[model samples]
Target: MIRTATPDDVPLIHAMVRDLAEYEKALDEARATEEQLREALFGERPAAFGHIAQDDDSGEVVGFALWFLNFSTWRGVHGIYLEDLYVRPEARGGGHGKALLRELARICVERGYERLEWSVLDWNEPSINFYKSLGALPQDEWTVYRLTDGALAGLGAAVE
Candidate 1:
């Protein structure tokens, strides 16, 4: 079963996020606290939204997808930016990830989103193949950039 996540699912989401981080060999950077997730997802003003998939018989959460909306100037329509998709190791071949992605696609269609996008690590060949099979092509023309720590702080100072 796939459904919208609630505040009560924060712990489960946190655990799964850490699991995903570990799987990707980035556990050291995964530090999402329950309070942070709750406030970001369930506060008066939600910063993002998420959906969780559970095993119907066992009632255990097997996967989740988190996303946010973005505006595409070129397309002149909104798009969904999938931030995370994680399925338990034991549940990989069970179609949970596909189901979650399809669900998000449906939401995108219903909302008239211009596109759905997510990034996959270059080394994750399995995921790259899966996405290719789903007709998703990587946008190699654009490069992603980030500002962190002192760089992020320096941005404000530069404007002044």
Candidate 2:
């Protein structure tokens, strides 16, 4: 069973986020709090959306996917930028990942979104192959860039 997440799902979602961080070798940077997750997903203006997959028999959540909308100037249509997709190791290989991705695509088609995009770590060959099997291509022409902490804080000052 897959469905949109609600405020009550925060703790489970946070745990999944931490698990994904650990898997990606960034456990030290996984400092998200319950409050942050609640506000980001359930506030008056949601910053992102989340969906959970549960075990039908046990009624326990086994995986989740989180994403935000992004504008694509080239495509002239909004796209879903998947931020996280996770399934507990025990729950993997049961088609949960593909199911979650297919759900995202369904949402996109419903909303008339032109694209869906996400990034997987270079070392995660299984994920890369899975995505490729689904016909998702890597945007090799464009490189991603980021600035955190002090650099991000200085953006306003630098502009002025």
Candidate 3:
């Protein structure tokens, strides 16, 4: 079963995030703290939302999807931007991942959102295959760019 995450789920979600980063071979970059997640997910005027997937028989949380709303000027509608989706290794192939995504899709349909989107690492063929199986297409023509750390600070300074 999938449900909205509550304050109690914050620690579990943060641990899963670290596990996911370790799996992706980027453990060093997984720097978010539980406090940050709590503030972002459950604070007043929350900036993001999360959904938890639990094991049917054992009632243990097996996966989670963290997402936020994004507006599309062309569609004049809000869409979901999935920041991260992670299922425990022991829980993979048990439909947990699909269930998490299905919940997100349901939310999109209910809200008249134009799209549900997330990025997968290019080298992660298993995830790519799974997404393709779900009818998700690759936006191969576009390149994603980011400005962070010193660059972001420098840019902010210039704007002052």
Candidate 4:
């Protein structure tokens, strides 16, 4: 079963995030703390939302998806930017990942959104294949860029 996550699931979310980072070989870069997650996910104006997949028989969480809304100026519609989607290794082949994504897609369709999107590491062939099988196309024409930590601070200072 898949359901919206509650504040009580913060620890589970954080742990899964760490697990995802490790799987992507970037565990050292995962800096999310439980307090930060709580604030971001359940703050006055929540920045993101989370959903968890549970084993019906055992009532154990098997997967999770974190996402946020983004505006597509060109499309003139809101889109869901999935930040993380992880299914425990033991839960592979159980359709949990696809079910999570299907739920997000349903949300977009029901809300009249333009698209559902997310990024995957270039090296994650398994995930890439899965997405392709689902008819998700990569935007090879676009490149993603980021500025964080010191670089972000530098940019802020430059603006002043």
lDDT rank order? 3, 4, 2, 1
Which residue runs of candidate 1 sit more than 4 Å off their true CA positions? none
Q: How accurate is candidate 3 locally (lDDT)?
A: 0.96
Per-candidate TM equals 0.94, 0.95, 0.97, 0.97
Worst 10 residues of 2 by lDDT: 151-160
Q: What is the lDDT of residue 10 in candidate 2?
A: 95
lDDT of 3 by residue, 1-160 (tens): 9999999999999999999999999999999999999999999889999999999999999999999999999999999999999999899999999999999999999989989999999999999999999999999998889998899989988953
Q: Identify the candidate with maximal lDDT.
A: 3
| Candidate 3 residue pairs in clash (backbone atoms < 3 Å) | none
lDDT of each: 0.90, 0.93, 0.96, 0.95
lDDT, model 2, position 109: 99
- In the order shown, the candidates' Cα RMSDs to the true structure are 1.3, 1.2, 1.1, 1.0
Instruction: Output the lDDT of residue 84, model 1.
Output: 94
Model 4: lDDT of residue 9: 96
lDDT of 4 by residue, 43-145 (tens): 9999999999998889999999999999999999999999999999999889999999999999999999999999988889999999999999999888999
